[model samples]
Target: MNFVKRAGMSLGARKPRTAALLAIFVVLCTLLLGGFLLQSAAARQEADAQRTVGVDVTVRKKGLTPALADRIGAADPVHRYSPEVPVRAEARGFTPLVADVPAPEGDGAGQREQGPLAVTGVRDLGMLLPFSYGSTKTTEGRGITPEDAGRNVAVIEQRLAAGNHLGVGDTVHARSADGRREVALKIVGIFQDPRRDQPGWAPPHELPGNTLYVPVRTAQTLGTGPAKVTEAVYKVGSPDRAGQLHAAAERILGGGGFDFRVNDKAYRDQVRPVQRVGAFAGLIVWVITLAGALVLGLIVTLQIRERRAELGVLLSLGEKKWKLIGQHAVEVAAVALPAVALAALAGSLAGQHAGDALLGRQGDEPVTAAGAPDTVTAPPAVRVEPAAVGKVAGIGLGISLVSTVVPGLGILRLHPRSLLTDSE
Candidate 1:
């Protein structure tokens, strides 16, 4: 009889044993496919997190102008950009917040010198650390955005707005100390600052309640000299891209007094855990494969010993020893195909739940937008794919061959006489 036909007959004759072996094969294949799926999912999530969470690059110099900031912000690697320019301005209409501490009894003596309110210009106020970190919140209307770049708009602290009886759409006036440059700003938002007047006597511009956020252009208009920014912040998709942004800045601003600081805390917080999950999944795959091979190999060896009478009968009929081994390999490999199919189905159904159990729930950090409302994106999810199935099938075949062929070697060394005598 053909070896393949004989192998099929043997499996049909031993239905109970075949069913038990088939059950074992399915469990091994399921775990192998699950591991592959997990590793693939973790890699995909890490890449997505890097792009969404991103890294912040801060460039600071003595006289960083708006023009230079714009040039750096225009880099391809930069996802979002903001330039900060701070200026002191005296309130024209309302009584601004003054320091509670007693004024120095000297040149600028006890004469109750009301200081100017703090005016900070930015391309996007939402991207400010205070607002993004939740230290300051927009309690009314909206905050200054990139669209307000050329417009005369402002977002004031709640206390300052309350003191002046200002609401959204109200106009406020401020002037330079010299009274030479004046700016009329329309209030678009009101933010709450959890700060009080300090004990030390300082200018109003340095006071927390007197702080106001406005478009970078509006603040620049109040200045006399060339328009300059205190510092510029650019956000890139990944920490590795910080070098690209730095190179772009070097090309435009040159390597001088400017320094670049990269903040990758968000990236580290988010991506590192996913990387560890992937590594653990890879380890699981190797360990499972080896264990499955050893277990199946031992089972095949014992089955061969019990089938000595059958093997002796086949050898007495002049069947080739290699064909005897080939029959056993064919039986094991036949069981592997259905096992892989069942594994693929199980993975497609339960992969996501397994991934979540392993990775746990990861919270997405909120991202403050330039001109749009605050948004948070959902994290990437685990999924089963054809590639993972194919890998499991390939590994299953290798396991079957190793389990059957190595033990089958013992049969090849015995002659037909010794085989029949041993059976007797």
Candidate 2:
């Protein structure tokens, strides 16, 4: 009989065993394709969300100016940029007794309990409200509004209020580090910092008790320099525009030593959790693939022993050993072809479901306008793509070949005399 006919007959005769092996291959392919597709989708979603990660450009030695901020605000793709002055101001009529202040820049450096508090004054003090991540809002009263600017108004952190025995309708008076500037402002609201991380690891100023939020005008009154604000914040739709933003900033600042800090942490935070998931999923897919290959190899190896008599008969008729190996390889490919098709269908559906589950969670910002209201929704999601299908099909074929070839080697070495003689 021809090798193709022989392979067909052998597969047809063991109907139950063929079905069992076919099911296993299908499952293996399905899991492999599904995992790969889901991983790719997750990575793509992270990349898309990356566009929303805001950027910060700080003027270390040279303070930011209102004219530069206005220019940045008018720039294309730059949304909701703000000018701010971060200053060290001493709190009068109150003393900080808290011991949680972090070590300062230099070795063993830290603020004395009697030291001045770090204050940030912004044009949009409300933007620093709790609604924004890396920000906080009032737990008691309310966040500072635009009306607070050009007035003696401040938003006190809850910790600051607790330490000072103050609340809404109270006052927080402070003098700038140079003592040349001083401001006494009424506290219209009290806020609580997220303080998610331990104070030891966070930036010293980010600590709850250490900061005070006020109007940009108030900051200017408390800070002495040619420039009014210290830094300018820009949300330029996507991080890929870093170059454009840098160039624009340089043009606005007349090309000095200004520094731009890209805040890609939004994307990082979204992806970091899923990265661990992707790595573990990738490892599991490979392990399962290897196990499936070994199982298929063993099944093929055992088939050689069972069909020894038939194989010997063919060998006696002058059939080459390679022909026998080719027959076995052909059979594995036949089984895998069907499995790959079925897995493609099953895996695509399963993978999309998994991808949807991984895309976002609570507190995640959508890839749209910065500070966009809920009315502006994210677009529809893509379930699957052509590249994913091609990858699965190609890998499935590779798996079929590898699994067949490994055990086909053992089968080809069988001696015809031994095969014909072995009755069992």
Candidate 3:
């Protein structure tokens, strides 16, 4: 009989063994393929989310100016760049509720409870905070525009505006906390802070409600130099580029008396957990795949022993050893084919649940070493795509081939007379 006929008769004669082997492959393939696909999808989603948040790094120097900001903005990796001039301003018309905390050294030799409102200026108002996109979304009239440069316009926090009974189009007079210099600013916008109260000790100037954002030129008037900036903030699409960004800044700004602080807190808080889920899924894939291979190998080994007489006859009839091996490989593959096909659907459903369980644990808030609470990143949405299906199918076929070929290789060494006598 031909190879195809031999393989079919072999499977038909051993229905129980064929069914048992097929069921085992179906279950193991379902787990291995599904777990692998889910892990891959989760990893992609996590990377996209991290890139959306963008890595943050601040450049500070005693004599740094907008020159550094300009050079960094021109860099290809930088998505956004802002030159910040942080100054203290005393509120004239109203006083927003300040958190009661012991202050540092002041004009009066004694420690003070409240400090002046923190007035921070930026070249681009859109790139305000480091948390993520829309962290400081405006809810009121409008944000500070490029045309508003040198126009003395400000965007105040919603809580500060409500506390001070201020609204859009109202002008507020603010005097420099240390000097006699003062400026009047028209309220242009009010933004709401999406960040929750984080646990940790924070300086008054770092408080969201205590900040007032203004244009670069307006804040420059409050400083000594025309381009004086206390902080130069830059955004990168990924954390791995932090060093690259720092190098670019140093190369362009000519590093001296400067400090570079890179913060990937958003990536750490959000993407790290999702990656962990993917890693766990990947580990399971390897374990299940290895176990499945061993189980299938044993089954093929036993089948080879039982079929030794049949192989001895085929070899004695002038059939090549490789053709005999191919016949066995084909028989096992035929049994595994349908099982692997059914596994595709089962794997998808099972993979989704496993992925969700892993990600759910990551959703819990992280405890900080410094007793400060931080925001937890939300899990990214995952979907098994057609590509994943194709990939899983490929992996299933590979598993089937490996399981049969390795154990069936011994068929080449079967002695015709010895196998025939042993079978009797």
**Please, what are the lDDT tens digits per residue for candidate 2 over residues 1-424?**
6778877887798888789878988888877777676577556554554444444333332656766676776777575556676766677788743445545566233443223577777765434323345345456665555556678787777777887789888876888656676778898777667765364544434456777777777876776554466666665545566678777777777755766677656545655665665676688678877887787878877877677888888887889988888788777777777887888788656665665565445124433232223222242143556676666566666766777787767756677787788844
Across 335-372, the per-residue lDDT of candidate 3 in tens digits comes to 66687667776755665566666666454443211111
lDDT of each candidate versus the true structure = 0.83, 0.65, 0.70
Tell me, what's the RMSD of every candidate?
Answer: 3.9, 10.9, 6.8
Top-down lDDT ranking: 1, 3, 2
Backbone collisions counted per model: 0, 3, 2
Better model by lDDT: candidate 1 vs candidate 3: 1
Q: Model 1 RMSD to the real structure? A: 3.9
State which candidate, 2 or 3, has the greater TM-score. Answer: 3
Give a tens-digit lDDT track for model 1, residues 79-152. 77889988767688888876777556673432223336778889887666666556677888888777787799
Off-target runs (Cα >4 Å) in candidate 3 are 52-54, 87-118, 123-153, 157-160, 163-165, 168-188, 191-211, 217-225, 237-239, 361-378
Candidate 3 TM-score, true structure as reference: 0.73
Q: Worst ten-residue run, lDDT, model 2? A: 368-377
